[model samples]
Target: MPSASRIAILGAGALGQQMAQHLRQQGRRVAGFFDDTCPSATTAEGRVLGPLAAVATEFAAGRFDELLLGIGYRHMARRQQVFDELRADGIPFGQFIHPSAFVDASVQLGPGVFISPGCVLDLNVTLAANVLLYTGCLVAHDTFIGAHSLLAPGVRLAGQVAVGERCFLGIGTTVIDSLALGADVRTGGGSVVTRNLPEPGTYVGVPARRLR
Candidate 1:
């Protein structure tokens, strides 16, 4: 069993609180939260640490070695900003995979990645930093998920699929084998990607055509 370590979860939203609960269950101590604006005194979590600007300083001062990003906003731009800031700060992010997840031994996961419950990752799958795989999603063999991408619940990626940086695959979406997605692309819920996507925009529907 891995010993408990000190960790700080950024963003005190619903996801953050849920992450805190899970980490605590794993015997990791959560040292409050780091948020720009403090919520109510009595929050889902006890207290907020401080503003976002203070994050790097706090991390450098040895406040926490690991950071879990729990903010689940839809906008990809905002997500990029947060990711970049964290990297610039030089704080190593922690990857959180639920105890129930089935990750293959050959799979490579980067820091700050989060895999929710019941997710299945096959052999030789590589997930870059800050990627999020929601519950029940499956990444097949030889798949590469780039940095800052989010795979929603039940999203399925076939073998040799290459998802670019900052992409968002909505709930129940499925990508056929060997397909590729460009950076900053967003797919609608239940979309089926049958071809390679190059331009960045909102994609929707079965067969997964671009909407924007």
Candidate 2:
């Protein structure tokens, strides 16, 4: 495993704090956070080093070896924008997997992936780049989560499930086996997806009917 001596986070919200804590617990140094909202605020974990505007200079000066995108699903486009910009500048992205997460040996994880504590990834699970799996989520065998998708805390996916890119699976959402969701799909919290969602839209309720 490659160790990052210093890492800069792109957000300072709940998820960002959790990521920082996870990194710290692994003995990796958290350089600081970069957020537009609270550029000068200090959190229990650490202080805000600077705004997002300073990322280029910081990266150039070798302040941090890797960058972690801590932004949430609501800002998917912004995340992608920043990711692309930094990637073009030759900055590398980092993956953070909590110590308590159970990822199978056969599971494949891409760069910038974040697997929260208590998450279980079964055999043959493939999570593409920048995929986010929140706490207590369960991904069964042979499941594929597309790049930039976010699985909220407690979301459960049965075997052979395929979630598309930029999709957001709400907290406590449950998807049945062998279902395929299209790109940009959004499911409400506690939704029970029983069938294939081939359209890009918001889905809610027990049967997970598309709402747009």
Candidate 3:
């Protein structure tokens, strides 16, 4: 969130802690963490406010201004489910785009989006809700990344590329221009995608072929 809103992260794991660190760098106040496993505990990020179940009640009481999901790429389904449910429950979600990233004015980002350091989102790029781009990724013009997709560090996408929901682009993966990847698609580290991936599957290699 760009405002002075006190953001609360859901889950205080490694991702949560790192997210807290970046948020702090941007001069944002962290209200605390809402973790089901570590209520009543305090961390380097902030105190564990309560379990996930208590988020609604606490929100109603004005405990925190907005929510950020620190759920990682490994749990894409769970991540999408939690975000949708919380949003449906009227919990406001926040976007955390790191100060070091360069996002063009024409870019559109959905809620709960986390953009890490040194990333570049060029003209007209659209990132759907709950999409996370790790450090130093690059997205060219007119690209659309679907909801809940995660791009690992240094992943690169050319212009007009369309990535489907729940997709994971591994570290250093590269997709050329005008390619459309189906839902649940995954690419291994260093994979180079030259064409469209219409089927949901794990792909790896220089010319990205689906793994059997």
Candidate 4:
């Protein structure tokens, strides 16, 4: 959002609080949060305005400039749902790229992307909407991560790799060049993917194998 400054976060859980902290660190003001679980009160980062339903109304009232999703990887469905619904309703989202991260000039990021500290995104790397990359992850050239994908800390993807939507690459996972991972694929921590994963399932081990 080019004109957005005050960002509102959805889901006031641990992720929400952490996002708020990073936003503040980036000198961006948080307009508060909207959550079903937390009461409408002061949280550690900001106040909880109301439920998710209250977002459009509040936005129309000029309460916040943009929105960001704090929904975690454990609930990919909910995260995607909230993002798609809110975005369809004309609520724009803001991205949070931590200061310590290095993104090349050719990298393309979609809305509501969160890049944590020390991450490196090389040339032509494309991260789709609502993609979250945790600390120290590295994406090589021409890598395309699809929408709603979550990459855990220290994940390394080589050149020309394509990761599908709603995929979760666990901590320290590594993928070689030119491979494609299908939608809804989940990899265990330290998994090394050397070939294309064409189906949706959980994979693990050095040379990643699908879990039975």
Model 1, span 88-176: residue lDDT tens: 76877887878889999999999889888889999999999888888899999999999888888899999999999989999999999
TM-score of each: 0.92, 0.93, 0.96, 0.96
Best by lDDT: 3
Clashes of each: 0, 0, 0, 0
Q: Give me the runs in candidate 4 sitting further than 4 Å from their true place.
A: 1-4
Model 2, position 10, has a per-residue lDDT of: 88
lDDT for each candidate structure: 0.84, 0.90, 0.94, 0.93
* Higher-lDDT candidate of 2 and 3: 3
Model 1: residues with Cα > 4 Å off, grouped in runs: 39-42
Residue 24's C-alpha lDDT in candidate 3?
88
lDDT of 3 by residue, 58-110 (tens): 99999899999988878888888999999999999999888889999999999
The TM-score of candidate 1 is 0.92
lDDT of the structure predicted as candidate 3: 0.94
Question: What would the per-residue lDDT of candidate 2 be over residues 83-177, giving only the tens digit for each residue?
Answer: 87888888888888887899999999988899989999999999998898988999999999998889999999999999998899999999999
Per-candidate alpha-carbon RMSD to the true structure: 1.8, 1.7, 1.4, 1.8
